[model samples]
Target: MTYALVRPARLDLNSYARATGLHPEAVRRLVALGLLEPVRDARGELCFSPAQVAVAARIQRLHHGLSINYAAIGLVIDLLDRIEELEADLRRLSERH
Candidate 1:
C-alpha cells in the first residue's frame, strides 16, 4: 500500500479559531455537526489538520457570503466530498488506461 509521506502541520483548535477568525463556539459547532474533523493531541486538546482550515474557510464563505444555513452547508459539503472522490477515481482509472 502506498502512503502519503507529506503530513500537514497540525494546528490546535485555539490557533485554528484565531487564524480563521471563528469563535470557539463556532468551531465546536462545526465539529459537532461533523463538518470539521479534529484529532486529539497528547494533552487531550482538540487539534485540526491544516487542510481543515481550507474546508473551514469554504464553509465560512458559504455561511457569510451566501448566508447559507448549517443544513444547506452540510449538503454542500457532502456533495463536494463526493465530487472529490469521483474525480480522484477518474484520475486513477485514466492513469491505468
Candidate 2:
C-alpha cells in the first residue's frame, strides 16, 4: 500500500490571528506562554497550522468561561488532552476483546 503524506497549509501570525478572531498580540502571547506551537519560516517568521484556529477558539472559550489565567489554562488544556488520550486507549482495549 502506498501512503501519501499530506502537509497542512501553514499560516503566518497575522493570518492565524485573523482566522482565530484574535489580535496578533494575543496570538503572540499565546506562543510565548507555550499554549500554541508555531514553526519558524525561512525568513524566521512564526507560522501556525490552520488546525490551530480551533485550538485558539477553545482557549478563548476556556479563558472566558472559567475566568482563569493563562497559566491555569495551560494546565487545563494538558488535563483535557490527557483525558482524551486515556479515553482512546480505553476504547482500543475494549475493541481487542
Error of 1 at 67 (Å): 1.7
lDDT tens per residue, model 2, 4-93: 597669999989988999999999999999999999999999999878888998899999999989878999999999999999999999
Best-matching candidate per lDDT: 2
Q: For candidate 1, what is the lDDT?
A: 0.89
Model 1 lDDT per residue over 1-97, tens place: 9898986689998899988889988999999988889999889999998888998999988888989997689898788889999999999999999
Each candidate's TM vs. the true structure? Answer: 0.73, 0.86
TM-score between model 1 and native:
0.73
- Model 2 Cα shift for residue 9 (angstroms): 1.3
Report lDDT (Cα) of residue 16, candidate 2: 92
Check candidate 2 and list the clashing pairs. Answer: none
56: Cα error in model 1, Å: 0.6
